[model samples]
Every structure is written in C-alpha cells, then in structure tokens.
Target: MSNFLSGISITLSAIALAVSGWTAYQLSQLNLLIDQQQNTITEQQNTNTQQQDKITQLTQKIEQNKALISSDTTQQLNSVSTTSKAQNNVIQPGQFVRQGFDNKIKIELQSVKRIQNPDSEEKNVVVVQMRIRRIVPKGKVDAISLNQSRGRNPETSEVYRTIQNKSTSFTYINDLPQDSWGNAYFWLKVPEGINVIDIVIPETAIFEAVPISS
Candidate 1:
C-alpha cells in the first residue's frame, strides 16, 4: 500500500509542473502583444501631428498670395484713373465746354483771323474775328454770334488755339479750323462764384486742326 501511494504522488507532481510551464509561456506572449500595440498607437499619433503642421503651413501661404494680388489690382486702378484725369485738359471751339464749378456756358469760334485787345483788368477776354465751326443741332446763327462779338465770363471761359500773335497782346490766338483734322472749338463762360481759369479736353476727341490764317 505505501508503494502505491508514493507512485500516485509522483504522477501528480509531474502534472502540476507541466501546467505551471504552460501558464508562464502564455504570460510572456501576452506581454509581447501589449508592447507591440503601444508602439503602433504612438506611431499613428506622430503621423497625424506632422500632417496637421503641413496643412497649417499651406493655409498661410495661400493667404499671402491673395493679399499680393489685391494690392496689385488696387495700384493698377489708381494709375489708370490718374492718367485719364491728366488727359482731360484741352479746350476747343464750338463745343460744350465745362471747366470749374457752376458749369458755365460759351460759344466756340473757329478760323479766327484776329483778336482785339480789350481795355479791361481781366487778361483773358479779347475780341477775335472768328468763323463758324460746328453749328449746334438746333442752335441759331444769332446765338453763336455772341462768341465772335462779345466776351464771356473769365473764371470758367478759355480759348484753345495754336497761333501765337506776338504783334497783339491777345491771351491766345485762334488758328484751328473745324474742318481741318476733324477738330472742333469749345468756348465756355466763367461762373459767378469762381475766380480761377483752367481748361480740360479729352485726348480721343480731336487730333489736331489746320492753321486758321492759311
């Protein structure tokens, strides 16, 4: 009976040893899997951070480009407006001319042979021998004759011409003919409130006129 009991005890000890070994092996494998999962999660987080940084940088660059384009467009528009204003400075005859405030009126005369110097304090007005340039659509000859016979307001009135008469003390000489070079004359009266004289004309309106004397 003692021999039989000893054999049974030995057999139970061997079975317990095998079970302990298997449990240790399973614990080791579980630790390895946990470590690998942690490493993968860390790597994914780093990749996401890098992608976010790149997107922020790209957005900043796009904003800067838009600002540059807006600045360039504004500068170009200002340049064009300044050039247009500079060109509007010439006055002709027989056309509706406006210069200063009050929108004064005048009659334009062409082919002026002479301008008589008036004995007045104003140095702008002078009598001139002028011919008709362009008759207004519904205007009368008597209304246009005022330009040849009488003087207009000095503040807004101006006479554009090319002939320089040094012999007489005229402010300017009228020598441009209406039919020559598709040119027309403009005459305007000075307003009651203003005390300055200036002229303005579009560059595309007329090319140049012929000599009035010839």
Candidate 2:
C-alpha cells in the first residue's frame, strides 16, 4: 500500500510542471504583440503632424496670391481711367490753341461754368473762362469778339451773345490789358439744357467741343 501512494504523487507533480510552462509561453507572445501595436500608433501620430504642417503652408500661399491679384486689378483700373480721360479730351487742363505771327498768343481754356440767367430765373447761363497769354513781346493777339455771331451751338445752330452791360467787361481791340496772362470771362445765355458750345477766338482759332461744368 505505501508503494502505490508514492507512484500517484509523482504523476501529479509532472502535470503541474507542464501547465506552468504553457502559461509562461502565452504571456511572452502577448507582450510582443503589445510592443508592435505601440510602434504602429507612434508612426501614425508622426504622419499626422507632417500633414498639418503642409496644410498651414498651403494656406499662407493662398493669402499671398490673393493680395497680389488685388493689387494688379487696381493698377489696371487706374490705367484705363487715365487713358479714357485723355482720349475723350474731357476737362483738358493743358490744351491750348496758338495763333499770331509765329504762334505767340496762346489761348487756354481755364474753366467753364453754369450760372443763373439774368433775364430768367433759371440756371441757363453758360460762363466761359479763357486764359489769354502773350508768349512773345513782339507779337499781337487780335481783339476777340464774344457776340452771338461768334459763339454758336453746332448741335442746334443757335447763337449765343455776350452779356454787354455797364458792369460787364466786354471790349474790343486791346481796349483791355494785352499784358501777360489775362482772365476773359464770357457770359452767354444758353438754352435751358444746352451743355456744350463753340467759340471763335478772333484771328486765332475756333475752339470746338468745349465741355460745360456744373
């Protein structure tokens, strides 16, 4: 009976040893899988950071391009405006017609204004301001006539005469100063809606397409 008990004890010890070895192997495999998973997660985070940097750089470039396009558009608009103004001869600031022997007298358009009509209560008077200048001391500027026969509306063929009164500065034949630059104001009664007219600067030239201002 003692021999049988010793055999049974030895068999139980062998089974316990095999179970412990199997448990240890399973734990080692689980640890290896965890380490590989951690490496994969770290790589994914690094890729995400690089993609964010690229997105920020692209956004900065887009803003810079927008500003450049806006500046170019403004410059193009200004260029078009200046060219159109010159081509139409509207509000010519430096245009002048010269006459007299060797072109000594220069008649420049200073200002064109709309004034109230003296005879009527409406604003139907056109005021033409001319700047007459003597370029050479030897030449002469003939007496300019501001009469209905001299001023004509080419569109309507209507005549416009100067306002000649005791207080008005209407004269002939150098009765006024023939000095340097002199201001000559020509006031004429125009139609209620007439905005443009032509004037003959006697012995010089006929100024055409003169614009009227408000």
Candidate 3:
C-alpha cells in the first residue's frame, strides 16, 4: 500500500511540470503576435502622414497659380484702358506736332492754298505750307523739306504726290537758325472742283480736314 501511494504522487508532479511549460510557451507566442501587430500599425501611420503632406503641397501650388492669373488679367485690363484714353486725344491741324525726342523739333501747319496750273486751266496745284522750329539746339540746324509729303482727298480716299520741281521755292532751306522757323511747302496737282484735303507726311501723323484756300 505504501509503494503504490508514492508512485501516484510522482506521476502527479510530472504532469504539473509539463502543464507549466506549455503555459509559458503560449505566453511567449502571444507576446510575439502583439509586437508584430504594433509594428504593422506604426508603418500604416507613417504612410498616412506622407500622403497627407503631399496633398497639402499640391493645394499650395494651386493657390499660387490662381494668384498669378488674377494679377495678369488686371494688368491687361489697365493697359487697354490707357490705350483708349490716348486715342481720344485727337491732334488737329495748325497745332504743332512734336517730332523726335523731347525738344528735338516742332512743326506747324501755316496755311493751305490752291493755285491754277499754268499749263492747264482745268488742273490745280494744292500748296501746303508748314513751319518748323528747333527747341533743343541753339545754333545751326539741318535743312528741312517736304519732298516726301502727300495730299489725300478724304472723300475719295485718293492720294496725290507732291510736285518736286514746282515746290523748290520754299520747301528747301539752308539758313534756318535754331529757335527760328522757316517755310516748307508741299505742292500737289489735282483735278478741278476738289477743295478740302488731308496732309500726310513721313514719320508724322496725317493732318486731317485741312481746308484749301482758293
């Protein structure tokens, strides 16, 4: 009876030891699984942060582009407004139209006269008289002529060339002092009955609605 009781006690002790070892292994596995889960969650959080940063940067770029477009549109509108205002200031005849840079020269329309052609009574010569004065230079000045001048019939839009030989009287000048003005004539041959004309000069704006004196 005593031997049997000792065998039973030893078997009970072995079973308890095996059970404890198995419990420790299960705890270790649980710890490993928890660590792996935490690592996966951390990686996911990092990826989410990077994606959010990219979205923020794109938003900033879009706003910057909008601002640039608005500024360009406003500048274009202001340019158009300034051009319209300048066009409203119409330059008239007899008023001095300045040429070149500041104080270079100013030309004035003195008079417009019509004379019957000596060769043909039906034809007429239109004379456009101009005066030029120097403002910047003090002494000697260059000779000025109306060789390239033209006359335009506003009603018909017909253009007439200046007569070279007949205009040599007052068109060409050699002794025009600075600050003093001289006469430059432009003669155009046209058919009879046409009165008012437009004077067109090279490098100058057209003189419109100039009445011809008979």
Give each model a TM-score.
0.43, 0.49, 0.46
Show model 1 residue runs off by greater than 4 Å. 1-5, 87-214
Q: Model 2 residue 170 lDDT?
A: 46
Instruction: Write the candidate numbers in order of decreasing lDDT.
Output: 3, 2, 1
Q: For residues 1-214, write the lDDT of model 2, one tens digit per residue.
A: 8889888887777888888888888888899899999989989889998898899999999989999999999899999987775555445677645453245567777766677877779997777777666655543434454443245787877777766641124444344444766766667666667667776655666777676666
| Model 3, residue pairs in steric clash | none
- Please identify which of the two predictions, 1 or 3, would achieve the higher TM-score against the true structure: 3
Off-target runs (Cα >4 Å) in candidate 3 are 1-103, 138-145, 168-176
Identify the runs in model 2 with alpha carbons over 4 angstroms from their true place: 1-20, 35-39, 46-50, 53-94, 100-106, 112-127, 133-143, 147-168, 187-204, 208-214
> Per-residue CA lDDT of candidate 1, range 77-143, in tens?
8898876544333224543332211111222333322222233443332223323233122222222
Q: Each prediction's Cα lDDT score? A: 0.40, 0.67, 0.71
lDDT per residue for candidate 3 within 84-196, as digits (tens), equals: 64443323464535453234556777777778777777558877777776656444444455676788899998988888675634322234445587666778886677777
